[model samples]
Target chain A: MTADHLESRRREIVLAALRCFAREGFHATSVRDVVRESGLSAGAVYSYFPSKAELVAGAVAPILEALTGVLDAVVLDGVRSVGEDRTPTEAVAEVLRRIYPIAVGGEVDYTRVAVTAWAEGLRDPAVRAIAERTYGTVRGRLTDRVTRWRDAGHLPADVDAGALGQVLLSTLLGFVLQHALLGDVDLDRYATAVALLLPRG
Target chain B: MTADHLESRRREIVLAALRCFAREGFHATSVRDVVRESGLSAGAVYSYFPSKAELVAGAVAPILEALTGVLDAVVLDGVRSVGEDRTPTEAVAEVLRRIYPIAVGGEVDYTRVAVTAWAEGLRDPAVRAIAERTYGTVRGRLTDRVTRWRDAGHLPADVDAGALGQVLLSTLLGFVLQHALLGDVDLDRYATAVALLLPRG
Candidate 1:
């Protein structure tokens, strides 16, 4: 296969694997399942993903990468999602908005898959590494944002930015968990709710 | 067996099931595995749990009940953990302190098991029902506390107590998710961090 063909083919297999993993779970899913899901021969699936573990990496990496993409827009380059002048609550709500797709949008809700990844991470080191990296980045970005909020006078002068950031991260983490399970709250309502707890000025 | 003997025996089986479920997962565990874990015969295990599904209920009910117990003491009977006059942040912190063992302290770390339950909840309706009832209770209590905070002059006059309450629940839910996965961030630090966002006066 040509280079483009190879990349796209790999992507195809990963998407199929992700669907299976998300719909079922890591423990319940096998490479055969991925093969059947992909409509590709077992040989073709095996050529790209040697085992279910590789398929897990294939499925989980992109989900975490997509989260990083949102962080890139929301945290690293605040210009993409919202302005520096926006309140921390607005910025957070924007982050959730951008990640709405990953969280609960589309046929495969990656947030649901992300929770599955958390469960998988408990037993699998590779999944653990991928998840751990994203969480670290999440915690770091949140902590930085809290510091900026304090420096910008959005939060109290004595607020512990580090811990507050973790709490913020927790709030986001909790949102993901809740949405993944119930998916009852829409983005606007969630934004309104979380805004009450965050800095306004 | 006598009624007391049967109850203790069931309790023993449930504990064993919880351990097995938490260590591995719901899909991975079997009635025989729980039987082995309980060191009881399959007949006794079956006599009590009947099946792996029942064993799941056997395992999950107590965890939820324990959480409800904490909420009862912390919310309905606020006089137990902290005074009603305490700040909402302080009360939330008190809730975390009280539930520490359930979150990340104990050997099984019900929080971890809770995550597994969440994973199982995706596929199992029984687990979902038990998990759902607790979440509803949690949301209701948190919302009630927020209303009290607003009425008691602890929050802004214009704050939406219902929405703010969901945010608070999200924070606690997020705390549980993070603790289940990372097991970092002690309760005191978490309390300090969340206090900054909530009403202190």
Candidate 2:
């Protein structure tokens, strides 16, 4: 196979593995399950992913990408647009508004997979590393925004950006978990609560 | 065996099952694993929990009790003692203070088991029912507190108790998940954010 074809096949296998993990969970799923789900032979799947841990790591890549994309589009964009007479609080409220629907809607497969990843991280060091790295990236992005907000005089000078960043990420993760478990939570009160946290002029 | 003896044996099996679920992800664990961990005969384990689902349900009982205890001690007490010159925000901050140590410390088996429960809830109806019911109980308790706070003029009259209750519970669960995934997250910022949510006198 050409290099392009090899990459496509690997993507196919990883997607199948993610579906299996989302449906049956990481611990219950084996490599054979991924092969069966992908409709590919054992050799083909094995060539792409040597083990379940590697498959999990591969599957999580797109999820991390999607997460970073949300942060950029929703959060970072808000910060950049703050110069247009928009308070940081309004910017954050806008981000929460955008996130609520995606978290509670049909596009929640990523959240489901994330919950499974947390469980898998307990037993597998490789999965744990991915989970940690994903959170680290999220925290880093959030901390950067918080620092900018503080420097711009939207946040209090004494506030620790890193700590606040962790809290923000944790709140977002909490929303994902609640949506996955309870389904269709009305986010108005949550949005209001979060709005109260942001700096007011 | 006497009734008391039977009760103790059942408790032992449930504890063992919880340990296995925490260590080995719920989907990967079998009744056989519980038997091995409990050091009991298969017949004895089977006699207590008819199936893996029942064992899971049994294992979750203590978790529910602990959760309710926290609600009563931290949240309910906060409401009752509102006349003691304590703001609702201070009550919640106190609760967060109590919870932070437990969630990040070695006594975090409950949080680990909770992560497994979320994954298991996806494929198992029994587990889903338990998870939902548990959240329902939590929300109900939270709603009662929100209503009390509003009625007592601590919360705005226009605030919806059910909605605010869900948000509060979601934030708490988010804290648990974050602490479980990333140990010893400094909760000062989180507490501050939540304090911002409470009505200022």
Candidate 3:
């Protein structure tokens, strides 16, 4: 195959592997499983990814990149809207609403893998690095937003922006876990509760 | 084996399966692996728990029971202190302090399995029954505490006790996930943040 054709094939195998991994898990999944899921022969699959870890890494890196993009957009939106007519809580909640869908969409698998990696990564260095990078980017973006709000006096004077960001991230993760466990369509009620958790001036 | 010895051997197999499942996952682990971990013959292991599902159920039921016991202690402590001289926030924090270790203990494997079961239970009726029983009891306890606080005017009139309990539960789960990921040792910080989320009188 041409280089471009090979690259496309690699992406196909990666996506298929993620679906299998999500349904089962990284360790439980085999090369044969990915081959069957991708409708590719064993040789064709081997041509793209060398190992299962490589396949997981390939699938996860892009999803993590996309999630970071979403988080960055949220932070940028908050910053751009800071000087606008809206209150800081409103801006923060608006950013949150933008983020809630990503957690439940294709990123649902991402969240699953991320949580698994977090627990398993304690022993697996390669997985741990990927998990840490993803978490750091997420936490960093949140800390920046909280810091801005604190500077604008949108929070209590003694508020620790760093810790508050941790709180917000923790809350968001909890909501996502609930969604993962319960297939509910009405998140508006939960969203309102989350909005209340934001620091109100 | 004697009946009592047989029962003890079965418990050993289930606990070993739990460790194996936690270290790997439900799908990655096999009956052989569990037996290897338990130092029992594979046939001996299966004689007690007929299937992996049964083994999983045996392993997790006690963890759920323990979790409910912790919730009961929290609610009972809150009720006992209801007539005592303490702020609502302080009382809630006290209960949280009593319950935080369950999130990050040696039994964390059981917690992981519980989480996995909770998510999978969404689609499986049999598993869902177990998940619902586990969640309902915890939610009921939390609802009781939040209701008590609201009636005592420790919470604002605008607060929904059920929603507040859900939020608290969500926050606790999220914190556990974060700490599991980051190796955070400070439950006190998390409990304090949760206290801040509750409505003040």
Best by lDDT: 1
> TM-score of candidate 3 restricted to chain B?
0.80
TM-score of 1: 0.91
TM-score per prediction, in order, is 0.91, 0.84, 0.78
Question: How accurate locally, in lDDT, is each candidate?
Answer: 0.75, 0.73, 0.63
TM-score, model 2 to reference = 0.84
Q: What lDDT is obtained when candidate 2 is compared to the true structure? A: 0.73
| TM-score, A chain, model 1 | 0.87
Interface C-alpha RMSD, model 3 = 3.4
Docking quality class, candidate 2? acceptable
Local error of candidate 2 at residue A152 (angstroms): 5.1
Candidate 1 deviation (Cα RMSD): 3.0
TM-scores computed on chain B for all candidates: 0.87, 0.84, 0.80
Write one digit per residue (lDDT tens) for candidate 2, span B53-130: 999999888757767777778677754455553444455566677755554354336778888888889789999899
- The superposed Cα distance between candidate 1 and the true structure at residue A85, in angstroms, equals 2.1
**Highest TM-score scorer:** 1
Candidate 2: fraction of native contacts reproduced: 0.46
- Model 2 sits at an interface RMSD, in angstroms, of 2.6
